[model samples]
Target: MLLQIDLQKEEPIYMQIVHQIIEGIAKNELKPGDDLPSVRSLGADIGINFHTVNKAYQILKQEGFILIHRQKGVVIHPDAAYLANAAYVEKLKRDIRPIIAEAAARNLPIREMEKLVETLYNEMKGE
Candidate 1:
């Protein structure tokens, strides 16, 4: 998975990990039954403590993005569960609302945001 972690940001590392994984799922970069690196391996790959990766994996499991199999490691779910739950949708809206409001406050036009989103989507899809 492609990820960029910001150590200076206020968000926890585990949350950052979770968010990126979720975005990967949303973008279809990760699919159902796709095996993920073990927490220890991911930590080693990312140069972080294994416990940090474990924490993120635990949350992902609880949130149903991944299923933890004994000895087999974690596997991503095919679809995001965020669309199935009102609370999840609300939480997503709440998370994005601040960023949208901030962009508006900074005089960033909605058209620009739309264009940027379209460009990003196209790039992600290699179209």
Candidate 2:
């Protein structure tokens, strides 16, 4: 997987790691059963602390995006339960609410916002 991190960005390194991994999965660059690099290995590759990579992995595991095994290391989750999860939907709403509110405050048309979202979704799917 190819991940680009910008230390200059306001977002933390771990979040950049998490977001890029999620984006990779969305773009079909990462898939179920695919093995991810070990935390230490990835940290070395990215020139970051192992703890940062581990933190990202732990969040991914908690969010049902990946599974960690003692012998096998880390792999993408084999099932799609995370998509159908009620908690996940709630989290999605919470995450999106702020963006929508900001758009509303800025007087952006709802249709335009919907189109923007659709465009991003399509891009993620490689459409």
* Cα lDDT of model 1 by residue, 1-38, tens digit: 76788898999988999989877886778888899998
Which lDDT value does model 2 have at 59? 94
Models 1 onward score TM values of: 0.75, 0.94
* Candidate 2 lDDT score at position 55: 99
Give candidate 2 regions above 4 Å deviation.
Answer: 80-82
Candidate 1 weakest ten by summed lDDT:
77-86
* Tens-digit lDDT track of model 2 for 1-127: 8789899999999999999999988988898989999999999998999999999999999888899999999999997234556887898999999999999999999999999999999999999
In terms of lDDT, the best-performing candidate is 2
In model 2, the clashing pairs are none
lDDT of 2: 0.91
